[model samples]
Target: MFIQIAIYGLLIALFPLAIVWASKDSNKYRKLIAVTLFLTFDLIIFGAFTRLTDSGLGCPDWPGCYGQANPFQAHNEIKAAEALMPTGPVTVMKAWIEMIHRYLATCVGVLITAQMIIAWWRRSSLRHSPWLATTLFVLVLIQGAFGKWTVTMKLQPIIVTIHLLLALTLLSLLVWAWMRESPPLVVSVQAWLRRLLPIVFLVLLAQIALGGWVSTNYAALACHDYPSCNGEVIPDLDFEHAYVLWRELGKTASGDYLPHSALVTIQWVHRSFAWIVFLSLGLTAFLCRKHEVLRANSNAIIAVLLMQFLSGVATVYFSWPLAIAVLHNAGAALLVLLLSMLNYRARAST
Candidate 1:
């Protein structure tokens, strides 16, 4: 089963490898990084879709569906499981969704492995250190382990949230590496703005973690209103039970079913902290717009922030539609990618 899965992953990876080989761009290494980054972004989105659809346990196992390479081979077992519990996690459609996500993830792993091999082979000619490529390869391996734990651990909230955050972290690192392939920016910025860039990036990461917590806990619908939770300016919340990080999904540390108030607390905190990130990024964009070198990037930051904010609100008001929820997830990844580039440019600038 493991060998079949690996071969399947290699087959999926060949499509992108072929693209890199046939590209008109002279710098194939940079192109490969860019393509991997794009696919990684798509993988994150599909992952959100998987979670939002409640397909995380669709296959009820790791790497393969029902210990088989593909859903088609395990159709009978999946059908039996569905018949046993019609509303349970394992359905034919969901097993397919879960497996497809794994396949894409495997393809990403192969791409990164290829990247590491090439980086070492041409280390002397490359502008950036080959260590970054190697580091990315290592991180992807760790991410895969967490992916396994996410399933084997029964989708524990903490484990699943960490999975989401690690994906964003990988995206951020890939963005930084990709930016290294380009010429450094030649503009100078105010001292305060230069220092503020990293601070805001850290704040953004904290907000993304909070967002992940909200999703993993299935708390998105806890508050049905925008700018106010549950129709109150400050809703009654249960912070005590809200943050027991090691507890099972929908349960307290003592293994009791979690309260609605705890879910409300989770959603409230995520939405409130988002305001802080929104203002910080908005201020950063306002500061950056004055510099000609950073104007375009600054504009992108503002646009994504607005989209992210609106989608988040829509997710609540619209009752967490699949498209808006996935858009919210994609927006968070975009913020990580854009902010990574901004920080690299800040450090690279005079």
Candidate 2:
């Protein structure tokens, strides 16, 4: 079973491998990195969609659906599962979504594996340390382990949140690796803004984790009102329950169904921290606007920041439409990507 899965993963990677081979550019490794990076981004977005649609358990198994490679092979078992729980997470559509996600993830892993081989093979000719490639390859393996836990553990909030964080972290590292391919930006900004970027980046990461916590706990719609939660300046909340990281997916540590107020608290904290990230990051971008090279990159973040905020509002106003919800997630990942670039440009050692 494992070998079949591994072969399926390699098969999925062939298309991208072929593209890199046919490219006229000599820097095929770098092109491969770029392609892998884009696919990683897509994987993160689809992960959001899968979670939002409650498709995480669509297959109810890891690496393969019903011990089969594709949905077609597992059709009868899926149909049986669906028959038992028609409105549950194992419908035919969701099985396909979950399996396809795993398949894409497999392709990503294979691409990174190939990168490790190439980096070591061509170590002398490379511009940057191949260690980053090796580290990313290791991280992908760790991420894959967590992917299995995400299933085996039945979507525990902490597990799911960490999975989301790891994916974003991977994306950030990839962006940093890609930046090494080009000349580092040397725009001189005041030391204060330079210092502020790292601070803002850390804060953004916390906010993302909180956002993930909210999503994992089904707290997105916990408070439907914006600027005010559930139309109250501060709705009643239960911090202890909400912040219990080790609890099961929808239950408390003692196996009770988690209270509604716990969900409220999760959403409240996430929404509150977002404003802090917005203001600090806004200032960081504003400081970069005067410098030419940094201006575009900074502006890209600001634009997405605004879009993310508005989409956040739309999420509440529109009651969490699928398209907007998925876009909100992609926006967060994009914010991380651009900010990583901004930081790399500022501190990269030439």
Candidate 3:
């Protein structure tokens, strides 16, 4: 069964591989990395869709649909689960969504594997070490483990949030690998901003984590208003309960139904932290954009930051439209990529 599933992933990966090979670009590895990064980006977005649609448990199994390779093979089992709970997380449509997401993920893994092999084989000719691709392969393995746990653990908030964060982390790693393959876009920066870049990256990551927490806990609509939440700047919140990282979905540590106050806390914290991220990323991008050498990097960062900010507000205003929410995730991934690129360039120049 596992071998068959691996074959499915390889077949899907071959579609992109074939296209890249046929392209006129002399650097096939670069093209492969580019495709890998693009697919990783799509995987992260589809992951959000899977979560938002409440399809995380659509298959109720790991790496396959109820021990089957595709949804067709598990159709009757899915139907049984759906019939038992009509509005539940497992349904035929959702099973397909979840399986498709998995299939895409497997394809990504296969591409990365190919990248590792090619990078090593061409080590003498290439400027960059193959270890970067090797590391990505390892991270994806860990990511696959988290993905499995996400289903087996029944979407525990912490597990699900970790799963989301890992997806973004995987995307960032792919960007890093892609950046290594290219001629470095060297650029200088102010000493203080140089000192602050890593901190800024850390902050963005934390904010993304908080956002993941909010989504996993289903706290997006905990507060309907924009500037105000629950009609107050400091809406009654229960950080004590909300910050309890390990808990079953919709239930407290003790297995009690999670309180609305807890959900409010999660939403409020994520909303509040946005301002800090907004200011820090804005300042960094603004400072970096002024330098001619870093202009493109800065432009990319600012564009995605604006997209993230607007999509965030749209999510609330439109009551979390699917497209906006998915874009919101894409924005986060892009921000991570651009920031990582900027940092890489700055460090290379120094």
Off by over 4 Å in 1: none
Rank candidates, lDDT, best first.
1, 2, 3
Question: Clashing pairs in model 2?
Answer: none
Model 1 clash tally?
Answer: 0
lDDT (10s digit) by residue, model 3, range 144-228: 8998899999888899888888887787778777777787664667788777888999999999999999999999999888879
User: Any runs in candidate 2 off by more than 4 Å, and if so which?
Assistant: none
- Model 2, residue 63: C-alpha shift (Å): 1.5
Clashing pairs in 3: none
**Candidate 3 TM-score over all chains jointly:** 0.96
| Sort order, TM-score high to low | 1, 2, 3
Cα displacement (Å) at residue 63, model 1: 1.4
For residues 105-202, could you state the per-residue lDDT of candidate 1 as single tens digits?
99999999999999999999998789999999999999999999999999999999999988988998899888899767798877788899999999
- Model 1: lDDT equals 0.92
Query: lDDT score, residue 231, model 2?
Result: 86
Best by TM-score: 1
Each model's RMSD to truth, in Å?
A: 1.0, 1.3, 1.4
